[model samples]
Target: MQLGTFSFVTKLAGFEYTKFVRYDDEGDLRVIKAENAGPHGFKTTNYSRVRSSSVAELTRSRLHGGELLMVFVGAGTGNVATVPEGKDFFLGPNIGMMRVETDTVSPRFVELFLRSSVGKALATAAMKAVAQPSLSMGTIRQIPVLLPPAEEQQEILRLVEQALTAAAECGADVREQQSSADILRQSILAAAFRGELA
Candidate 1:
């Protein structure tokens, strides 16, 4: 199913409509703006919250888990993310959210697809701009989604995540090994210069 076939909404721009409030102490509403959602993905630790004070804000701007977030405008034109679990965030400017309404469509799969090279290419092709690049809600709603069955989607997501984790671990190991090798080389040079190689 197309992503927006479920439900979609852009972040509101009513400054006056929002009450200046922070969840830093009370922990109610958290705002995930475009800046918080980078091209890499959404980070759980950025800790930026909404500008709304009244609980009525939840009636519209509330973001549930498992929605695919996309950077619809500006420099981050193609950035996408699956909202992490444990907390819900309020969507902010230059961002779009597609909350999957059916068990048939996997949100994780959609997020990964949008981040893939093919998906990025499609988004770039649809992009239009004068000063800043942007993808209209229509463009996103019509995105050609590859729907494997739910089980296949889960398996693919699991395997891809595992592979990515292994790759990251290998990279860290390589960096650590290289750093030790550099130190050893420097030590060998210092010993030779001091005629301690004997």
Candidate 2:
């Protein structure tokens, strides 16, 4: 099934990318910058904040938890992510958003498909601009979508999530081992210097 046929609500935030922030940890809104938008989930702790005066804009631009956020410009052109529930963020510029109209499609399913190799190829081909690669609302809408049976879609998303969780655990384990090795080496060196390792 093609994407444009749905009651899908797609949008590109106002032109002010994630800029001009005096980050306040306790700020009301989390401003999604192009840099923090990733293939997995976002790096929430490192994002910018929405000022009190500008906070009203969030009423319109704030994410409703399940929409897929795509980087439409600069180095992150084709990357996409869905902000987790309970946390809302204002869409920054160069970022295009696809609000999941779940009655017709699942948000996680759509996001996972778009992040796949074939989906990325479609986005790469549709993108424009040389200096700062960008995608317009029209170009994004034109990208092809392959809709599988609902059961198949659910299974794929479940498996992918499980694999990602395992991979992340392995990465953390590797980092922990590396840190332990470094500390062991330092202790060995200290002992040798004190003639205790002779």
The residue pairs that clash in candidate 2, if any, are: none
- Per-model TM values vs. the true structure: 0.80, 0.80
Each model's lDDT: 0.74, 0.71
What lDDT is reached at residue 194 by model 1? 96
Q: Per-residue CA lDDT of candidate 2, range 85-106, in tens?
A: 7877766666777775557477
Per-residue lDDT of model 1, residues 17-72, tens digit only: 35533445455667777765676677666666553454444455677777778888
Clashing pairs in 1: none
Output the worst ten-in-a-row residue range by lDDT, candidate 1: 16-25
> Highest lDDT among the candidates is held by which one?
1
